[model samples]
Target: MSKISTAILRGVSGAFIANSGVGKIGMPAEYSAGVQQAAASGIPALAKLPSDKFGTWLGYAETGLGAALLAPFVPSRIAGAGLAAFGGGLLSMYFRNPENTEADGIRPSQEGMSLAKDVFMLAIGLALMTQGDDK
Candidate 1:
């Protein structure tokens, strides 16, 4: 990957991650609902956390990850790995709740649509990691 390609990938993924975090802050109702629904996702006591506190902290973490991925000195591969891990967790959450997906499971239901968008993050993450050697 050329520097320009790497930069573009990081910029887009970082912005999306940061935007999602910001949305959690601005849309408390939707954010809280999503958090509550994670109770069956095998995430330990995530749902037990107070909604506001959970949302705030999650927002910070996502925002920080986005920022780190965008930092010039940060290794692209490392950033990509971090983003990929986060995407995996999100994807896991989706699978843990089958009702959120279509009958076929792979296709997302109405509610799972938002979660499905994380595929882009996963792809971008892998792209950054794989292309690191070329930069």
Candidate 2:
């Protein structure tokens, strides 16, 4: 790959990692809800030991993994794979929730756009995973 391409890849990877880290931490409610749901649906006895504890751990894991991906020394491909997997899980959850309609306070058009963005970002992450750090 060209020097410029590598630079662009690195910049994109860094930005994505950092931004995702912040989102994961800032949006603890989202992850917490997932954990709670998983626990309620017979996820695992250990995981459901304490709902609040599980939620906190899930939040920490999300933020920590995201930050690790942002570190300069980390391999871009691994980071991308992690983020891609996370995005896929999120996408699946969002789609699975039948109650997530505009009637639930989420504007249908905006939700569609957000879903598109998530899918696009997931594609970018998968592309990065397949392509490695450089073009």
> RMSD to native for every prediction?
2.7, 5.6
Model 2 worst lDDT window (10 residues): 39-48
Compared with the true structure, what per-residue lDDT tens digits does model 1 show for residues 1-135?
888889898998898788877766644766665775673383656767776567667778788888878787888888998899888778877777787699988899999898888778888888877773634
What lDDT score goes with residue 100 in model 2?
A: 41
Could you tell me the lDDT of residue 15 within candidate 1? Answer: 87
lDDT of 1 at 113: 90
Model 1 misplaced regions, further than 4 Å: 23-36, 39-42, 48-50
Return the number of clashes found in candidate 2: 0
* TM-score between candidate 2 and the true structure: 0.58
How many backbone clashes can be found in candidate 1? 0
RMSD of 1: 2.7
Model 2, 35-124: lDDT tens digits are 667434333343445544556655566666556555656666776677687667656645555444355534434544455356654775
TM-score, structure 1 vs. true: 0.81
